[model samples]
Target: MTSEIQSYNFNGASLRTLTDGAGEPWFVAKDACDILGMSNPSMAVTALDKDEVAQIDPKDYLGSENRSNQAVNIVSEPGLYKLIMRSRKPEAKEFQRWVTHEVLPQIRKTGGYIPTSESDSDEDIMARAVL
Candidate 1:
């Protein structure tokens, strides 16, 4: 089955994400970098462990208008956390929480995630993050 890009918003910043065949989450590197205020996505991705990053063609995913053969960078969960840790932006912590708390769970449960108005308690969010 082909993967689909799902966009999740954290404080108005959009993060495009997808899952591999193994069900592990991956984020579009540029999208994550943009939200984290990273100026150079390629350089930022280089700082991550080799296993945590990959190059994917747009044709592999649905909802992409890009037909170029050029491969785009994608970061696994660990890489995403690494980027989050490196970020000096004030929103980093909140963005981490949003991902671990909401985005991850929805992706795990339904294979897709996006912005939502529902709010869960910190305790609940933390619990979900642990699972």
Candidate 2:
């Protein structure tokens, strides 16, 4: 299967990503794990739900015949969030915000998401006040 992988930078770290047939984004597990300060990518991936993980050949996306046949691990959005929550690093929250507010919107902008009204409601005001 052919796939296009996109790369996003967070605090100078690269998070390589790709979308599935349904247009849902999947993040490179090693990249995310490294950003989140996880020592072992494979071990961290095992903690996520089976449905929240997948394997893909880098050759398919990179189009490099010289690349090895070893499949790379990827995580769904939910799985990424789970890893973020597990992280003890101080910058984890900032990374999460970047992913949600910036990266995801751009990725889904092609077809899947439709934004709601920009008008601020009472709840929005209250939430902002609390922050």
Candidate 3:
């Protein structure tokens, strides 16, 4: 399937721009998916509910697919962020193990790291560190 990049808002929150201090962009949905061990939107939602990932709101998009009109807002939780940081294109099984074994435990130990209300998924996490 040809993936389309769309702007997503997380619960009506503000969106963040993805940029590195070095002027580089970070984190794409396809890459994020592989990193988070999520094969679909449902899995992403589940991960968010479990507090295994950081949430983000996609306010605008660059690619053709327009999900801006969808009913549910999309988010990228911390677990997925961790995975994405480790591997921009991680294998499915590898992503799963990292999320279940490493990422989840970290979040639990930290008592959960909630994404800032101003966080945005359309941008790179490292670039939007201030959020």
Which numbered prediction scores highest in lDDT against the true structure? 1
Cα lDDT tens digits, model 1, 1-131, are 23767676667777787888887889888888888778899999999999999998777773445667778889998999899888988756777777678877987997665344458776776565556
Model 2: lDDT of residue 86: 88
RMSD of each: 6.3, 9.1, 13.2
TM-score of model 3 (CA atoms): 0.28
How many backbone collisions does model 1 have?
A: 0
What ranges in model 2 sit over 4 Å off? 63-68, 100-131
Q: Cα deviation of 129 in candidate 2 (Å)?
A: 29
TM-score-best of 1 and 2: 1
- Compose the digit string of candidate 2's lDDT tens values, residues 9-89: 777898887888887789889899888888899999999999999898777774662266788889998999899888888
As a whole number from 0 to 100, the lDDT of residue 39 in candidate 2 is 81
Among the numbered candidates, top TM-score falls to 1
| Model 3 per-residue lDDT tens digits across residues 17-110 | 2433443333344445534444664454453444343223333443333356533233334544544444434454555565566646866986
Candidate 2: minimum summed lDDT over ten consecutive residues — where? Answer: 109-118
Least lDDT summed over 10 consecutive residues: which range in candidate 3?
Answer: 1-10
> Clash totals for all models, in order?
0, 0, 12
Error of 3 at 89 (Å): 13
Model 3 has an lDDT value of 0.43
Better of 1 and 3 by TM-score: 1
